[model samples]
Target: MKTPEAGDAIAAAPRRGPLHGLVVLDITRVVAGPYCSMILADLGARVIKIEHPDDPDYVRGFPPFVGEGDDRFSAFFAQYNRHKEGITLNLKHEAGRELLKQLVARADVLVENFRPGTMERFGVGYDTLRAVNPKLVYAAISGFGQTGPNALRPGFDNSGQATGGLWSMNGYPDRTPVRVGTIIGDVSATLFAAIGVLAAVREAERTGQGQMVDVSQQDAVLALTENAVVKYTVDGEIAGPLGNDHPFVRPYGQFPCRDGHVFFGGYNDKLWALSCRKFGTPDLVSDPEIDTMAKRFDPEVYARRVKPVVENWFRERSKAELEAMAGDDIPLCAVKNIREVVEDPHIAAREMIVDVDYPQGRIGMFGTPIKLSRTQAQASGRAPNVGQHNAEVYADLLGIDAESLQRLKSSGVV
Candidate 1:
């Protein structure tokens, strides 16, 4: 596929997503905010990403570059910012702030991830933008939230994980709890912010009034701790990491194979019996000591009677061999690394990985997980260079011709 020129992509290639006609003004940088607007862009919203004229998105300077020197681009930024139009504006400048207000007046949604009062400091906060366009769905994503006591504090992905209590329940119980392998806090908050934006947009369409949608990274991560809070409250028991072992299920954890590891879930009676039969120990199914599910769940019994046999059986077989043996009867899966995942036939069949073309070459990125019957939800364009669409956007939206745009650029307002 040929790569479209930076400014021309959005104009030339029309989106066929469910939000085809929705216009989004994205004043967000980095993961949480960019990820949210990226979702909207993938779903067919016309997203216009505005960055600071002097200081662009920090990720644009990050490593893992493609091309050389002046032409080099950050693959990290590209993956999350694809399918959106790009422009630059100096929010600190009066004319620039006014320009943003004008854009907001015409936009259906505006998303920002700055600290709670950052936008308000610049005179373009939700209240200001809402006043400009009452129907605008304003989404504010932050570490704490817009109204909390900690809203003024600076926060990052790790801050969310730590503050939300997710970090306390991860990793082995004997060691210090570790943060999740990926940026779950930011990503979860992104998903929630997108949902909020969509819901607010729907309500706006119904009543011709838009409201603020505030999402906190810490709040989102706390919501994802899933029963940990209830476990502590109801049973008066604090949950800690069990080193991949389920607290209740006996044989529902990862075990080593000849080459690597595989997760086995023969915790139930029927599956346990099937697993025991497959291990060439059908007699163990009726064994008095470890026969029933309840008995198997006992840690001492599992360690003494079941773990040894299960480990011995697994150690003798490679991952592929164990998978073949388990087939569909026993719930088992070989733990795969990134390389295997990229090469797996199942992932390919589902179109979970895709490539976006750049001026220099193509960079591979994860495809959209959303599937719709009537509309497409995929990354169909490349990330734009800073201010790549300034002329196009300014001309089309604000009626700024080439000379006026050059003046604005020279004045450092754009």
Candidate 2:
């Protein structure tokens, strides 16, 4: 692909701040890729999420569809696709494939999670796209990688956890391997995708050439559990799961209090002494055997010595009192369910949940975590209806007449 000439690099459409004039075309559905696009969208990029016309986003038909049959909207879709425009493209058709090629010429970033060979099979691979646009960043999220023995394998989040090391590190030693409560591995891949996209974008800005951002679910999972990986490699000892307890650290997990449980990690002497003082059991300070890491690992001695004292103290104190007493000397947090967390003062103050207007009055938007002060990121748009922008985007961008647009719609092409 030839480099863009100064004349070919026309003045870009301005946006509010950073990511101004950026264009993103997202072809992936469900969690990971959508999460990456959502972050980019929140950062002021114009993200166009392409869905198939005949069989829309699988999320449209995913169970928990609200209101009516095939409503074309779902909670899962709404959460992942906030702050983006959506249009349907029947990629199975030649005309539709050509349209994608055209869009690639103008787009800045293209994201997809189709099985390994699907994009190349569609004639819209990077080598093909770069001919039209040299600075087009193509991102792929796959199970293993774009090329590998397991590259084409389906990257189900739970299955990836099992294949990755997370499952082994999740449960108690003797129990069945447990998967995490939510889509953790998927989020992990999304994080990797986000980092890759931004880095590629930065490189393209410097060199005026785009590159491939390949993210593997397997790689992402292993990347996340770094400590466990290092432990295994260093000692040749498989890191075993210890449930709510830390394997190497003492009293570094959840403990039951009067109202509920509280998680605390006493990582050092100062914190450990503070915990002991708070519980009015300062005797823990003098025991040189209990004070050090090696002594704490003596399971029988440590368990019998610490458990009775810690449990009795926790059993007498309420969660609030324990939280107040523990202070910042140790990391302590009361276990909170979703309902409690939604109502939490810090969460509310941080605007983690905002009232977003929907057809059914106002629904909460549990928004993205990052808060940009100078240029605030928001879901300026909502999750779109299928082909909602058919007239605006197709007719305007594709330069198709209204009659032709309607004709294509009638022919199920839009």
Candidate 3:
């Protein structure tokens, strides 16, 4: 089987967006790190995805593949890797390490997700690379960060959620704590890492000095618990799952409809009054037991007075009917399933669901959420095959000619 050339199946589109001209060396694999780099790529950064020649990224073999034979590739991998260039370099090899250093000298940022000391062992850690290019912003995404007792411990999304106290607070109070629907730990860390990288890059540009941005999955997930930590510390109250209910707000939860469920938020007094009128229960507004926000916030009062009336109103209507009634008056929305979300008029209008063309076929993925008026963030092009840009990137970045690149490939260096 003949291998595809650089940009053979997926041609490189002209760079646009806010991050145009930024050079990113993405030496990460799998979800977290690749996702962060993908965000940068979507924002118009020139991201070069580097991988080991022999091993490649594990996600390349993941399921839900597209195409067949040599043209086959993982849809899951493409979801996070699109709009970036790909190259393979055996970083374990001394020559490959030297070549990476040369590339680093020209890069503005480098992102990696290996364990704490992996880069140091390879002699290309932040401290080493920062010296190679003093203005380079090195961002490291790890399970437990680069410091503390758990630094060396292997961490994953589940472990991060478990140790960070997010897992214990999810699900129903009577049931076993469930992990969040998605890999929130990894994803939150990715967002934080990207922010840190951009912030550090800005600083580097101004001060002509670079620094390391350390982002930990556990730390990021813990930070996103939304007052769970403070509620325990300040009020001496350990919060547990309340199903779909808000902790402090009455009538702020999912209510049953004829067809399905709808989330209704009438927590404030004004909204409560508005909701009461909208639900054809205006008399409930002046009821002494649950008249004001404070009274409705009382668990006993809400359970006895508020829940029954609001739930009854919702149960009498279908999701569509309830939505139509709510309109712009009440803060409510029908709970949408995945199919509904994909087909939703709002989602379509916002361009949240986008289709990217590939050699195999056109696959739909989520578009960028960040919308800049001038330099719009967008996802373009398809992901590259392993080492697809070896010759191009090597020759372009390091001045390595065709002869030298072939020699390096022959020596198992790139």
Candidate 4:
């Protein structure tokens, strides 16, 4: 309950989960398969997930955990279901698809996204779970792939960012296509379905077996701009959006300040000449068209020369005094919302918000961006419930018992 600071603990720790003793099997769902099994349960994979108990997770009922006071389950389904282990099953019965093929014969991995041929019409795809785990891996994720021609349509992440042109280069050049305010194509197709299940779990730990990866969310938003596909293949120009500015960088972006907005990037020419000497205008940083960011798009010729002297010196400064008058000489920030980014003080000294508890109590929980230094990773619980590991992953990974897990949950199959 402390650590967070080295730049918000490298964006809120969690790196060590290098799939500690593997064993996934999520069977995936919303948010690109629960964000690729919560990034392989934050690198320590021991996932299990499943879910169904009379159909739950449509992001457990979506919303910042449905509240007008007591709805439950969501904070967007506990932000991609923390470190796994929930349960419940029906898999349209056959003893719950033979209890997910005997938990894929003791799984090594087996995510999913269900759509493109809905797991080969539920025989549990990947060639029937590689005949019950020939060293598994499996992954899938979808929306626009998993077998061509719009693989049975139905996507989202706003239709895979407007069919993958990333909402036609996202907002502002005469407005319209925006969408990037989160769910960036379902967290970039859940980081390419956790990099295709850690490259098929490092080739099933060196060819003991396993394969079938897939992934797609419109091919991860067209591989997130191959530099706008090499500038629309060497200039037939089509890039749009310019809302906050910066593709190359000149006094970077968003500048209000005095009690609001304060971004800033200032790419070069000595941070746009230290933002024209802290806005007193040391001669508009030698103005070759607003000193080149390929010309700050001549926004009304640099807003009649330097946006009214940096918007009247940020109307007398305060986004922490123009972020302490641009310290590292540039690269600053401040445009926050969502209650100033969940009470940010560097997002609470970088734990990016923690405290979990669940059934909707302590709350918070939104960390992990990636960091390592001796294998960090976190969010060890919360987001379980529905069948919540029905008697510990059904008598330890299907060795069954407890009256065959209560006659497979009174024969509903779980």
Candidate 5:
């Protein structure tokens, strides 16, 4: 498949997504904001990224460049900001602010991730923008939200995980709290922002009035705590980590095998019996002290009677052997490393890993997970160079001529 450079004429391509013809002013940077914008872009929104001419997105400086010298580009930036157009605008300048207001006037949505008061100080808050375009859906993603005492404090993905109780419930009980391997906080916040913006956009279409959609990273992460919040409130139990095991379910965690690891879990009696029978330990199923779910909760009985039987069976078998023996109804899976995941046939068949060609080489990144029946998500394009669509957006959308654009560039207003 051919991947076009974002510098190519984006307007010439036919839009194939549900968000076709919608315009988005993408003023956010880094993880949460860019992630939301990327989803919009994939859905066929014409996202125009705003950046300072002198200092573009900080991720542009991150390592793992695809080329050398003038052609060098950050792969990190490409991972999140793909499928969006770019334009420079130093908001500190009056001309820049005026240009942004002009864009806002024509935009269907405006997304930002600045601290609570940042947009208000810049004179482009929801009220100011709504005054210009009443039907514009304004989405704001912040660390703690637009209100609350901690709204003014600077925050990042780490802060979201720490404050939301994710870190506390991640690791083993005896060890210190450990952050998750991936940035779940930022990713969850991004998804929540996208959902909020989409909901607001749908409502605006019906009511003819757009509203503000505020998403908090901390709140988003906290919503993913499963039963932790309820466990404390309802049962007076502060949930703690239990390693990879299910908190209340016995025999529901990773067990060591001969060559690799396998995770098989089922809380019900049927699954428990099947697991015991599959492991060639049918005798253990009828053992009085370890038969029922209630009896399996005792660590002493589990270690002495149950653990040894399960371990002995798994220790003699390989992951592949165990998988072959267990049927589909049995919840069994081999723990795959990154390389194995990249090579998995299921992932390839699902198109999870996709490639985008650069001037230097082809780079692989995870594709959009959302699949629509009629409208498909696309990632087969290069990330834009800094301000790559300046002339096209300014001259075409804003009706500024080449001479005026050059002047704007020279005066550091673009």
Candidate 6:
């Protein structure tokens, strides 16, 4: 049986997404960089993922491997790497470096998440690549930005969270800081990187000149500091963790339900009155000390009156019951766990959960959340195998033959 080729598989598939004609040279691994490229690939860009011939991506060895022996695959790797062609290239070698330059010449975008100078050391940095492909959108995601004093400092999601002030704003006020459940910093940095790449790609199309997109995970997290930074800068206030509560909003935050927790809160008088009406507590709405935003949000007033009343109301009802009553009247949500989130009716109706077929079987993955009226994106296929498109990409794009491809593989140049 003939083996399937990577670029051929995507190229043969019908092109329906908005980014149909774009080509992305994906030199990223792990979360942030791969995620940015994966978004491009999902939007119908032909993303060629370049890796080292010997080591490949470290995430390929991550746990929850399926199948047996050498064929085992990592679920973690598959999560962010779907819908891209994988190719191995030993960039340390001059032959491999030239091969990448050739690919770069034809690519529209290139994304990498290595430390600041790693790509330069490999001789494939933005400066070198832009010399070859003047219109290529080059994006880099790192812990800090490219030119900061700490740009060379090793950083990860945890580092971004801690240093960017997100850690200080989470958890209860009395407890030590806690990392968020997921790597929000890494994920947000990827999203910002994608946005940067798309914007640069647009400008490049107009001017025929590509630019660099430098995204720092720490900077991304700092950008999302919300009211924390501003409050300090403006009001001389230092915000601390409020335990599931909104810092400046009363009756807003997590509360107890009969079965599980509910996130129900009111920020303004109108919503607070709506909440009071829903809970059959109209008298509280007229209470002089807690009628206004300033009064209601005051810590002492909230602890003495507002929180107790709202918490008592929610505690008596099941999450479903509360949800039914609060429908559109107030902003309330049942704090859902992973299983609940996946199985949610709203999530399913919105097509946020989708089935993706793999070699072993079908598994459900989070679907594209960017809904558009004109051109829709899709999760085209499963992740590719290691160097899965050597013959096809090299032959079709670089004009190398099957025999030469094999020779390159034997010499570890590809």
lDDT of each: 0.88, 0.77, 0.87, 0.73, 0.83, 0.85
User: Please, what are the lDDT tens digits per residue for candidate 4 over residues 41-96?
Assistant: 77666777887677767667667663455446576677778867788888888878
Backbone clash pairs for candidate 5 read 88-414
Model 1, span 7-70: residue lDDT tens? 2222323677899878889999989999999999999998999999889999998878888888
What is the per-residue lDDT of model 5 for residues 112-140, given as tens digits with 9 covering 90 to 100? Answer: 99989888887878898888778889999
Question: Which tens-of-lDDT digit does each residue in 1-414 have in candidate 3?
Answer: 122221222223377878887889999988989999999999988899999999999999887887898788788899899888899998899988888888888788999999999999998888888777888889999999999999998889888899888998899988999898999998999999999999998998899988999999999999988989999999999978778888888879998989999999988999999988988899988988888999999999889888999899898799999999989888899999999999999999988888887788778888878888888888756888999988777766666788878888899998
**Candidates sorted on lDDT, descending:** 1, 3, 6, 5, 2, 4
Top-lDDT candidate index = 1
- What local lDDT does model 4 show for residue 119? 69
Sorting all predicted structures by TM-score, with the top scorer first, yields 3, 6, 1, 5, 2, 4
Candidate 5 or 3, higher lDDT: 3
Model 3 residue 217 distance off true place after TM-score fit, in angstroms? 0.2
What's the TM-score of each model vs. the native?
0.94, 0.92, 0.95, 0.38, 0.93, 0.95
Residue pairs whose backbone atoms clash in candidate 6: 252-265
Q: How good is model 3 by TM-score?
A: 0.95
Give the per-residue lDDT of model 6 (tens digit) for 253-340. Answer: 8888899999887769999888888889999888898999889889899899888898888887898999899898788889999999
Which stretches of model 5 miss by more than 4 angstroms?
1-13, 297-304
Clashing pairs in 2: none
- Overlapping backbone residue pairs in candidate 1 total 0
Quote the lDDT for 109 in model 6.
91
Encode model 2's per-residue lDDT on 324-398: one tens digit a residue. 887766688899899988999989888788765657344565876888879877754477787776666654445
